[model samples]
Target: MTIVLTFMPFAVGIMDNDLRQLLAQVARGDRTAFAKLYDVVSGRLFGIIGRILPRAELAEDALQETFMRIWQRASSYDETIASPMAWMATIARNQAIDLKRRSAERLAALASELDETLADESPDPESLAGQAGDLRRLGECMQGLPNERQQLVLLAYRQGFTREELAERFKRPVTTIKTLLRRSLIALKECLDGAR
Candidate 1:
C-alpha cells in the first residue's frame, strides 16, 4: 500500500492537560494510564512518523518504535521542558529518522545487491560466522538486563548518546548515569563470559 506523508499543523490545548496527567501516571508505572495515553496520542504520533517515512510499512515500523521508546522512557518525561505531545513528537521524529537511515544503510550494504564478490566485498566465511555468533550471544546477554537498563544501554552504545544527553533524557544525575552504565556493562560482560 502507498502511504502519502505530509506535514500539517497539530491542534494543541485540547488534550494537553489530560496528556500531562496520563504521562504522570505512566511514569509511575501504570499500564492502564499508558494504554490511555496510547489511545489518545497514537494517531497524532503516527502522523508525525508518517511525515518522515512515506512508505506505509516503514512509517508503521517507526510508529511502533516511537511507542516502544515512549513506553520505555516515560519516566524521563519532564513537563518543564516541553508539552507532552511535543516531547513525544520529538521521539517519533527521531525514531523515524533512525528507521529511515537503517533502511537505507541496509539496502546499500546488502550482499544481494552486489554483482560480483571482491576481496573487500565481505569477510571470509569463518570471520563472518564468528561475528554473527558473537552478535547473537551479545543480544542474548543484553536481554538479561531490565527493560529500562536495556534502553539506556542501547541509547548510550548504539546511538552514541553522550552521558550528558543520557542524564537529560533519563532525568538522572551524571554520576548516576555513569554508575548505571558501568554496572550494566559489567553485568553484560559477566553474562557473556559465563555463557560459554
Candidate 2:
C-alpha cells in the first residue's frame, strides 16, 4: 500500500519510479493501475486544486478534469525531465487555471448581457458612494494589520484556506492558526468600527 503523505513538503524521492511505472500501466489502459495511481495522488491533487479554485464544487470539477487528462496523456509522461508527481501536479495546476478562465469568461459574458438589458437603468449615486466609503474603511482596516496577520487573513478569507491547511503551510499547530485568525479578525472589526 502506498502511504500518501499529501501535506508533506514537495521533495523528489524514490517513489517517482513507482509512479512512473503506474503511469505506464495506466497508459496501456490498466484500470487497476489507474486506481492505484489515483489512490496515491488524489489527496495531493485535491489540495492543489482546492488552493487554486477556492470554491469546493469548482475544485471538485477541476480534480475530475485533471484525472481525465492524466488518463488520456499518461503515455506522454517523461521521467527524464521531471518527477512523476511534478508532471501530474503541472497537469492539475493547468486544469485549475483552465477552469478559472472558463468561469471568468462565462461571468463576463453574463455581465455583458445584463449591461445590455439594463442599459436604460442608472445606478443610484448615493448607494454607490456609500459602498465606496465602506470599501475604503475596510481597506484601511486591512492595511492596519501586521504583514503576517494580513497574509494569514487574506489566505484564510480571500483564498479559502482552512485552518489545517494554513497550519500545514505555516508549519504551525492548527489551534495557533485559529487563534491568530480570531485575533486578527477582532482587530480588523475594531478598526472598521472606529473608522465608522
Candidate 3:
C-alpha cells in the first residue's frame, strides 16, 4: 500500500483545529490521517526529543516511540483538557524521559556489576590518593550549590532518580527539575574547571 503525507502550515497563535480533527480521524484507524498528522507535527516533536535526549540517535528513537504511543493512545486523548499539540508534546516528552531513565538504569546496573567484580582489586597507594583528592574536589564543588540544587543533583544523577520521580518527591514540575539539573551541571562544570 502507498501512503502520501500532507504538511500543513503551523505557527504561533494558529489554532490546531485541523490537527485535532486529524487526530480524531486517526483514532478511528485512518492510516491516511495518521500520516498527515505525522507530517504536521513530527518536526516539532523531534525537536522536543532532541532537546531532552543528548544523542541524535536516541532522540530519533524517542520520536518514533512517541508516534507509536500517539497512535496507540489517540482514542484516550481528551480534546477538552488539552490541545492536540500539547497532548502530542506530552507524549514526546514522556518518551524522551523514558528513554533517558532506561539508559541511566542500564548504566547504573553495569556500574554496580563492575564495582562488585573490582571489590577485591587493590589500587596502588598513589592511585588511591589521587581518587581521594578527586572525591574531595567533587564534594567541595557540590557544596557550592544551593542546598535544594545540591539535593536535586544528587537525587537525579547519583541516586538515579528520574525527572518525573524527582518532580513527585520535590512537588515541582518535571520541567523545573530539568532546569535545576541543567543549571546545577553548568555550575559544577565551572567550579571543577576553575579547580583544575
Candidate 4:
C-alpha cells in the first residue's frame, strides 16, 4: 500500500503568510516566491484598481505596472505604517493615476479629430439621462447626503480625481480634500449599511 500526505505550509504561516515576508524573499532575489505572491494578491490588487479606474484597459495597464513596482521596490516597503499589500496599494493607485493622465492627454490631442458639424452640437439630455441610469442610482444615494459629502464623492469617483487632484481642482489644500473624502466615504458606507 502506498500513502501520500499533503502539507500546506502557508496555513500555519508558511506559504499563506503576509506579503512582507514574500517581499523580503523577493528582495533577496527569490523569483519563485515572488511569483507565488503575485498569484495570491493579483486578484485583490486588480479589484482595488478597477474600483478606482473602471476601464478594463487602464486597469490592466495599472496592474502590470503595479507588479513591476512590487518586484523593484520590494525592499523599500515600510512595515511599520502598513503591510506589504498596503504599499502595493499605493503603487497601484499611482499607476492608475499615471494611466488616467496619459489617457487625458491623448484625448486632448485627438479633440480636433471630430468634425465641426458634429462637434458644434451637444447630445440630448434625455438620451444621456436614460443611459446614465447607473450613475443616477448612485447619484440619488449621494444626493441624500450633505452637500460637502456629495461633492467629495463625485469628485473622487466621477473624474477619477485623487484627493490631491481634487484639492488642486477645487483650489483648496490637499489635507482638506483628504479629510472630506475619508469622512464622506465612511458616512456613505454607514448609510448604505443602514439601508441593507
Best by TM-score: 2
User: What lDDT does model 2 reach?
Assistant: 0.85
Residue 95's lDDT within candidate 1 is 97
- Per residue, candidate 2 scores C-alpha lDDT tens digits across 156-177 of 8778888789999989866567
* TM-scores for all predictions: 0.53, 0.56, 0.55, 0.49
**TM-score of candidate 3 on Cα atoms, chains taken together:** 0.55
Q: All candidates' lDDT scores? A: 0.83, 0.85, 0.85, 0.73
**Per-residue alpha-carbon lDDT of candidate 4 for residues 1-196, written as tens digits (9 for 90 to 100):** 9899987553433433457778899888799988988898899789988987887878999999999988998888777876676778889888888888887776545433322312444568777766465445555668778887687778676666676778887887665565566566666656656654
Worst 10 residues of 2 by lDDT: 113-122
In model 2, how large is the Cα lDDT of residue 173? Answer: 68
Q: Encode model 1's per-residue lDDT on 1-196: one tens digit a residue.
A: 9999997655567678888888888888899998999898889889888888978888998988888888889889988899999999999999999999997776546423321221244578778878887789999999999998999889977788887899999999665676677778879879988987
Show the lowest summed lDDT stretch of 10 residues, model 3.
110-119
Candidate 2 segments exceeding 4 Å error: 1-12, 121-196
Better of 2 and 4 by lDDT: 2
Rank all candidate structures by their TM-score, best first, as comma-separated numbers: 2, 3, 1, 4
